[model samples]
Target: MHIVITGAGRGIGRTLADRYRAQGHSVTGTARDGSAEIILDVTKPDQQRAMASQLRDTAVDLLICNAGVYLDKSESIVGYPTEMWAQTFASNVTGVFLTVQALLPNLRKAKGKIAILSSQMASHTRAPGGSYIYRSSKAAVLNLGRNLSTDLRHDGIAVGIYHPGWVQTDMGGPAAEITVDQAVDGLMARFKDLSLENTGCFDTFDGQAHAY
Candidate 1:
């Protein structure tokens, strides 16, 4: 598979890139630091278009929208800085939208799949309090996946919103239950099984579907 992963400079995204490469797949990664195959800021349309230009003639089998940020340190919504909340949404939500939108043509050529990196906290059915900024952003991504799936169904593209679980990465912190390798491995397993029939579903790394 020719896969494109975002936020690949570090953490789960980096680990996923490595894993895919190890599996002998062609992988392209994007990050703000310019450390991957492409330097892309998901919030910027110019950057996304530039990245698309770089892959213009190529068809990507998979696009993983994995770039995100957390504001767990903030105490409460009332105490949260509105600017910070907007920034978080820009990276986590809007970034995913722009990146996927920019890459749709390439993906359509391949009848590809899009895997969005969401969070367990996004589940309204299993709602957990706190981390309001992070939680809400992920929830928004879940909806994006749903709407995108509906809109793209006739295009033969599959979309999945996934929770990698509490991975032991910078975002998940050191005490997280799963290692980045394990998390990525599980997601890969799930990715292999994704199909248009299940597009718009929310899933965890372990292959179980989540309540949206």
Candidate 2:
């Protein structure tokens, strides 16, 4: 299968890209700084267009919208700046939408699947307070994925939102619960099981259904 992953320079996305490649799947990993196979800043429309145009003749079997930011992780309720919220949403919410829109044609051509890397923090049930910008952006993308799933049903495209767990990556921190390898393995399984019948499902990397 031909897989396209955004923000694959590190963390879960990087691991997924490497694993897929090792499995003999064609993988195009994109990074914001041209550090990976493709140079795509998910927040940029022109870059997205360029990517779509470059891959015009290729069929994408899977498109993983994994590029995102947690800009407000350090913000407190008293000091949450407006710019932080806007920047976070641009990459985490709008970026996901733009990627889907830009690659819809490729997805339609191959009847592909889209795996959106949302977070359990997005769930109303999992609210533990703080990180307002990250939480809200993730919640927004979850909504976007669900609606996109319904809208693209007839096109044979499946969309799923997932939480990759509290992985021990740069973003996830040293004290996080899961390792990158564990998260990647579970996520790969989840992606393989994704289908039109299960589209728009929000679940953990380990396969448990998560409450929205």
Error of 1 at 199 (Å): 1.0
Q: Give the per-residue lDDT of model 2 (tens digit) for 1-212.
A: 99999999998889999999999999999999877888998889999999998898688999999999887778778987999988899999999999999999999999999999999999988878999889999999999999999999999999999999999999999999999999999999999999999999999999999999
Query: Which candidate has the highest TM-score of all?
Result: 2
Kindly report which residue stretches of model 2 are placed more than 4 angstroms away from their true locations once superposed. Answer: none
lDDT of 1: 0.91
Q: How does residue 200 of candidate 1 score in lDDT? A: 89
TM-score per candidate: 0.97, 0.99
Give me the overall lDDT of model 2. Answer: 0.94
Q: In model 1, which regions exceed 4 Å deviation?
A: none
lDDT of each: 0.91, 0.94
